[model samples]
Target: MIALLRGFLWLTGFWLAGESLVVLLDLPISAGVVGMLLLTIALLLRIGRLEDIAAASQPLIGLLAMLIMPGVVGVFFVADEFAGQWLAVAVALVGGTLASVLTTLLLMRRCMPAAPRTETPQETSS
Candidate 1:
């Protein structure tokens, strides 16, 4: 219970700091996205531990599907515009997905250490 409160406070503090930095720099990026990125960096640096926030985050994470409701609803309003630009939308979707996948692969390759190769028993027999 205490850990959950601490986690919430930590997340809120980090988010406000990131948002303020974005506003101060006059960055075009969204504050929420910047906050999320900051949180990710903190986690990667071990400054924020998942376990510390797991309790509080668990319910919110579980209800994440509900959060998509607005996006799903918004899509209906854009359906006509999307249909008119289907080809461009398709291209953008594919390009964005590919770019995201490539970026993720590159980041993982750089951040994670490669596993040591192990010799098979048959090769040892030789």
Candidate 2:
């Protein structure tokens, strides 16, 4: 319980920092996203442990779909604004997904160590 409280504190602290940055810069991005990026950088730098975040995020992850449902539903309220641009939206979605997948694949390949190659029996016998 104490750990969960600490985790929430850390998360909220980062989120507030992100929101402050957005307000200062007048950027047009979600503060939560910026906060998450900051948190990821902190974790990668060993400034924070995954266990701390996991304590809070594990349950949230379980409810992710439900959490996103409001945003999905909200889109319907603005559906008329997109009445004639569905093809553009579809193309953007597909392009973005493919770009994300390709970027992830390339990054993983570059970051991960290659597996050891095994010689076949025939090559070994020769």
Best by TM-score: 2
Cα lDDT for residue 119, model 1?
A: 41
lDDT of 1 by residue, 1-126 (tens): 888888888778777988998999999987878888888888888887688766667777898899988889987788776677888889899999999999999999999877556745457675
Q: Work out the TM-score per prediction.
A: 0.56, 0.59
State how far residue 72 of model 1 sits from its true place (Å). Answer: 1.6
Off by over 4 Å in 2: 74-126
Could you give candidate 2's per-residue lDDT for residues 33-76 as a string of tens digits? 99999999999898766787789888878999999898898887
- Collision count of model 2: 0
lDDT of 2 at 53: 76
lDDT score, candidate 1, position 12 = 82
In candidate 1, stretches whose alpha carbon ends up further than 4 angstroms from where it belongs are: 40-50, 91-126
RMSD of each: 7.7, 8.0
